[model samples]
Every structure is written in structure tokens, then in C-alpha cells.
Target: MDFGCDPGEWTDAWSATGISHHWALGTGHCIAELKALADLMDVEFVEVDPA
Candidate 1:
């Protein structure tokens, strides 16, 4: 699944559905922080070209 820019707000949604992986495009500003949050949730984080 993909959580564009609201990863934090979507945590509950992700957990409810048992999602463990996601792609976050155009997250250059907070990629590191997002990755850390994903790690805390035991989810895999992938980066992709936003273009």
C-alpha cells in the first residue's frame, strides 16, 4: 500500500489491515524520519521516484 504524505495519520489504518510494506514517494524532506517510524511499526519502507 502507499501512504503519500500522511504516514503518521495512517498508522491505525495500516495496522488494522495488517499492512507491513509501503512506498513513500516525494518524501525527500522527511525520508529518514518516515523510515524510522516505519521501523517502529515493523514495516518496510521503499523510496520511489515521485515523477
Candidate 2:
């Protein structure tokens, strides 16, 4: 998914168990893109810290 021109980058990092997908999104524009995606998908966006 390309969100126009940006200097931020992302990667699809997989765990050793290969059972989960982790996504690390950048700041600023990333927030907008994520919110837009959630709105388009008709889902609530919730962020939880796995501490």
C-alpha cells in the first residue's frame, strides 16, 4: 500500500514462531492513513500496548 510521497518506511517482520504479524507504522501521515483505512473498513481503531 502506497500513501503517496513520504519519507517513512515500514516492514513486515515475522516472529520466530511464525504465528503473528507485527506492523510498525511511522508517525504523522501514517496515523492519517491508518485512520482512513479503519474508516474504510468500517471498524474501530484501538491501540493497545503489549507491555
Candidate 3:
């Protein structure tokens, strides 16, 4: 989560379809890690208020 982005560096990197696809895959891996942690603690992973 500590992504250090230089100005204009990520602009063209994600402009192509293949690069965008890879970005999506990487994001999915992050989500999977959060889910795994939640499961280990027996907690539900919610992104909104539990009202």
C-alpha cells in the first residue's frame, strides 16, 4: 500500500490495455490478502458502515 508514485510516471504505464489488465490483477491480489487476514480473525470484511 505504500506506493511511491513519481509525477507522470504511471500515466503512460497504465495507458495500454495489457498494462491495465496487469494492474487489475495486482489489485486483486491485494484484496485477496485482506480477505485472508479477515478470515484468520473470523471477521467479516466490510467496506461500509455496519449500521
When 2 and 3 are scored with TM-score, the better candidate is 2
TM-score of predicted structure 2: 0.35
Instruction: Tell me the deviation in Å of residue 38 in model 1.
Output: 0.6
| Candidate 2: 10-residue stretch with minimal lDDT | 5-14
Every model's TM-score:
0.43, 0.35, 0.33
The candidate that achieves the highest lDDT relative to the unseen native structure = 1
Instruction: For residues 1-51, write the lDDT of model 3, one tens digit per residue.
Output: 333475356555546445434222234446778778778988766542213
- Model 1, span 17-38: residue lDDT tens: 8754654544588888988888
lDDT agreement of model 3 with the native: 0.53
lDDT, candidates in the order shown: 0.71, 0.54, 0.53
* Lowest lDDT block of 10, candidate 1: 18-27
Clashing pairs in 1: none
Q: Give per-residue lDDT, candidate 1, residue 25.
A: 47
